[model samples]
Target: MLSEVYPFQETAEAARRVQLNDHLGELGVLCLAPSPGLGVTDATLRSRIGEDRITSLMAA
Candidate 1:
């Protein structure tokens, strides 16, 4: 699953995964790109990094 935190990096990774999947197809392998979504629990919210900081980073 792809993390929603770093969208740009995740997007690049997903693209690479797609390319890899094409190669894997020859070996009967499969690669799936799925989003886990921006799920921040209460525990995460109480961590050192707040939701606002995470949101700002994501926007960056």
Candidate 2:
């Protein structure tokens, strides 16, 4: 369920980790979640789109 909402990409692991961490960080701060738990983890969100395109999304 969480993975469906935040899928992952097949990009380099480093790049994926950085982008995912940033995205989850932003979402965590926005939602004020204690932490990026099962609701927001690499495995949980390793299939969603637009996660790598966070620069554009954040600017907007």
lDDT of each: 0.38, 0.35
Per-residue lDDT tens digits of candidate 1, residues 9-42? Answer: 3556556666776323221111231223334546
The sequence of per-residue lDDT tens digits that candidate 2 reaches over residues 1-60 is 122122233235435555767443322122322333433345445456445632322211
Please report the candidate that would top lDDT against the real structure.
Answer: 1
Error of 1 at 25 (Å): 25
Evaluate residue 21 in candidate 2 and report its C-alpha lDDT on the 0 to 100 scale.
71
Number of colliding residue pairs in each model = 0, 7
Model 2 per-residue lDDT at 10:
26
Runs of candidate 1 exceeding 4 Å displacement: 1-35, 56-60
Number of colliding residue pairs in model 2: 7
What is the model-wide C-alpha lDDT for candidate 2? 0.35
Give the residue spans of candidate 2 off by over 4 A: 1-29, 36-39, 42-44, 54-60
Candidate RMSDs in Å, in order, are 11.2, 15.1
